[model samples]
Target: EPEVTQTPSHQVTQMGQEVILRCVPISNHLYFYWYRQILGQKVEFLVSFYNNEISEKSEIFDDQFSVERPDGSNFTLKIRSTKLEDSAMYFCASHNARGGTGELFFGEGSRLTVL
Candidate 1:
């Protein structure tokens, strides 16, 4: 069985530094997304990418954030300037199709810590 994979399971950074989170989704999946959970907060949808462009994004994905599928096999999310509020567990997910009954495969998540 295939699954989403993320790198650098935990990262510690200073406030205002840049961070890049990477993900490799299931090979057959087409839709990819980034979500985040801040400590004890609920999970929040950040952005969804498909066909090499953003299909949907939440307000959280603002000027400081960007996402890209750099290659056929890898997807990445970048935060230009991290803030204390940016500390969280970032998850990567994928599905064969959007808004379908098909389940999504989620990565273990990359935890970002900003000091």
Candidate 2:
């Protein structure tokens, strides 16, 4: 089965630095989303995008964050300035909107550590 793929399963960065986490979503899916889990916290939605523009974004997706589909297969999340609070596991998901309720297929995760 086709699956979402994320790179750099683990990363350590200093606070206030820039970081780009990469993902390659399932080939045939139309909608993509990004979510993060802060340590023991519940998974939180960051943003969802379709047709090359943002469909919805949570408050957590602040000015310092951005996303892009740089190619047919790759979707990327960029943080202009990271913070200690940014340490979390970022998961990339994709789904076929044709299904009435969205059921997402997620990548394992890209774990970010800030200090």
Overall local distance difference test of candidate 2: 0.95
lDDT of each: 0.95, 0.95
lDDT of 2 by residue, 2-92 (tens): 8999987999999999999999998989999999999999999999999999999999999999999988789999999999999999999
Query: Which residue pairs in candidate 1 collide?
Result: none
lDDT of 1 by residue, 1-115 (tens): 7899998899999999999999999998999999999999999999999999999999999999999998799999999999999999999999997556768789999999999
Model 1, C-alpha of 46: deviation from truth (Å): 0.2
Candidate 1 off by > 4 Å? 98-100
Which ten-residue region of model 2 has the weakest summed lDDT?
Answer: 95-104
